[model samples]
Target: MPVNLPEIESMELYPVAGVKLGWAQGHIKKANRKDVLVIELCEGASVAGVFTLNRFCAAPVTLCRQHLAGNKGIRALVVNTGCANAGTGEQGMLDAKKTCNAVAELLAIPQDAVLPFSTGVILENLPMDRLLAALPNAVNNLAEDNWKDAAYSIMTTDVAPKAVSEQLNIAGKQVVVTGISKGAGMIHPNMATMLGYLATDAGIEQSLLTEITKEIADLSFNCISVDGDTSTNDSFIIIASGQSEVQFNSREQAGFAELYQSLLASAQKLAQAIVRDGEGATKFMSVNVHGAKTMAEAKAVGFAIGKSPLVKTAFFASDPNLGRILAAIGYAARECDSLNDLDTNLIDLYLGDVLVADKGGLAKSYKEADGQNIMNRAEIDMTVKLNRGDVDVTIWTCDFSYEYVRINADYRS
Candidate 1:
């Protein structure tokens, strides 16, 4: 069980006005499981996305990019779990296209207007026959309030279905944002191990949608880690259906700022949920790096700490191993070529509220029990002050455990 991660007791996902979703038990990997999802977007909907930086990205990712670039105005999305359709070369590409074709044909939309996504084992071909056969069931079941089912359908190793919804009044019209994401292992920044879908009814230009999607992805999905491995199928997509009467000409528009904030908050919650439910995760950890010379440097430091297996295990053991954190920060500074100008003597570190290290060394009044007490909790906050400049960043992560090793070792079996 994930530590401090609550089971979403009630499905309260609000319906985005111009979006509808459905799922089917394609049995792509497991029997009688909802392994496929279909999202139907109304005409005039604008969409944008950011995908994994991994050169070995999945076939569906390639198709998604190509289709998006064509500017046909995406009207549908097909997602499958069980076979990632990654590392399958040309056949994988063909399989992805076929799936898109099936969805497009079923919905009577142009083939280029469909985007596809997949997750699961790598280097295997998707069960295309079964997947294609399930398309009609998904289309037949489409409904505006199917967000929760869509969330469940996209899971691979996720312990919980992550979903979030928010609504705001824009120019007297109610606009809604609802999103879902899934990830557990093979997770890290540079686009963590996840597939995220966020949709809103507020209207925005397609170009602006593309720009803000990348921006929101940076502030959300790109700021989390689980096992330090960026998956090949990582993707985050945002859509604007324009069902509401409100439209924004620019970021300066009265309601744009509020809508953007709500969107970011929803994305952040979904991202954090992935870390909270990380494979074998027993504690949710937040690493905050402050007073850095640049945001990149701050993020580097936070990831260095967040991705350190030694640091994660120490937290798992409830051990106050402050030295491990210092080592990680030093290594990050060196790796990012910030060490020469980084003044260790000006650094300060805290585990929760206890100052474990000050001026780059042990705090004179620090106590081991104090750090241990904080580490023993299901949630932890680590604060590091570089005292270099004004930039800051926070990265979410989880503690490693024996179960994590076991889960991955037996993953293919």
Candidate 2:
């Protein structure tokens, strides 16, 4: 039941100058526990965000995008679970704006400073009064060091909460990066069904924050998969409090570039944790596609393999169904010179070196005992070498099981 990834530390030790962590109970479909969270950032802090690309994205995303475009920096974040403010049409938009206004009023900040996000059943009108009632208590509980609690409060069907932090030394000052995210199903990112919040104590320019956020997202959230279903609500935001006082001007080329790379690594670590905890996931999987003519082609092959039902189901079965892997690649790939040209004899499909599949077909060596042993592990890696060209890409996914179906099918009930 334990996760196999490295233990991700929390960044609570850092001094966050202008942020408060708070949560409110109730307002959920099965209310009884805290489901609303509020993060109040200090005035003049820079904010950057990434959202789902689904055409039917939630009302909150549209509003957030509009605000960000206007360059109206945020000072507050209001998040809720149990009622995704989506698909309710114009009414949902009004409710979302009203929710933000309420939080702004409570915190005495501008409405544009309040960014709102929601998760859970779509098409239901948000319970504004219930959520508003809990805001005072949530604000009262706000603390400088509650990253773990903030991560846990946003869960819907997730089995465990996800949070990560890292400290990097730059120009003699330690920059702290802390992040938390929630995702279990309806995942397969054009960014997925999830919300991620990243906070940093280091001082960085808004332009740099914008660039780093976009680049980091391409490698992390954009490269994960679960059930291949994109949601109407997916959001990730980063807040730079500038508490570290480590300023980086565009002129400081070397130092700034290095610092930006480190930030991306920290963000990527938090994103992978969400995929590892994917619903009904017995094993966390990584799919690598190499030898493509272009990055687009490589990503296409990666996602095709990652989202394949046959490949995922075979993974759940631990059957080492290499044929399914090849099938997915063949179907999703843009161009491959010859399927038969692949070196089937030298191919090694290993379940921890068990060699369940060889070359282009199932290993005559596939055994039930050996397969079951591999399936028992909490994490799995599926690697395919095209041996065609030089391009490469990797993506994360979890096994598909009946539990996954049950969770999503009855998600609203």
**Candidate 1's residue-wise lDDT over 1-413, tens digit each?**
86666565334788999899999999999999999999999999999999999999999999999999999799999999999999999999999989988898899999999999999999999988899888889999999988888989999888888888887877788899899999999999779989999999988899988988998999999999999999999999999999888887688888888988988999999999999989999999999999998888998899999999999999999988889999998889655776557888999999999998989889999999898899899999999999989999899999999999998998878
User: Which residue segments of model 2 deviate by more than 4 Å?
Assistant: 1-15, 251-254, 334-376
Q: What is the C-alpha RMSD of each candidate to the true structure, in Å?
A: 1.0, 3.3
lDDT of 2 by residue, 1-413 (tens): 32454443444434356677887786567757668888988767789998999889899989888878778778888888998889989999998899888888888888987788999888888887887787787787787686777877888887777777667777777777777888888887768788988887766678878877888788888888888899999998888888776776463654676667766776676667777778887778877665655666667767878888888888877766556766776676343334334444544455565656566567797786876676667676666665556777778887787778887788877
lDDT of 2: 0.76
Clashing pairs in 2: 25-34, 291-389, 344-359, 344-360
By TM-score, the best candidate is 1
Question: How accurate locally, in lDDT, is each candidate?
Answer: 0.91, 0.76
Question: Which candidate leads in lDDT?
Answer: 1
The window of 10 residues in a row where model 2 has the poorest summed lDDT is 333-342
TM-scores of the models, in the given order? 0.98, 0.89
Model 1 TM-score?
Answer: 0.98
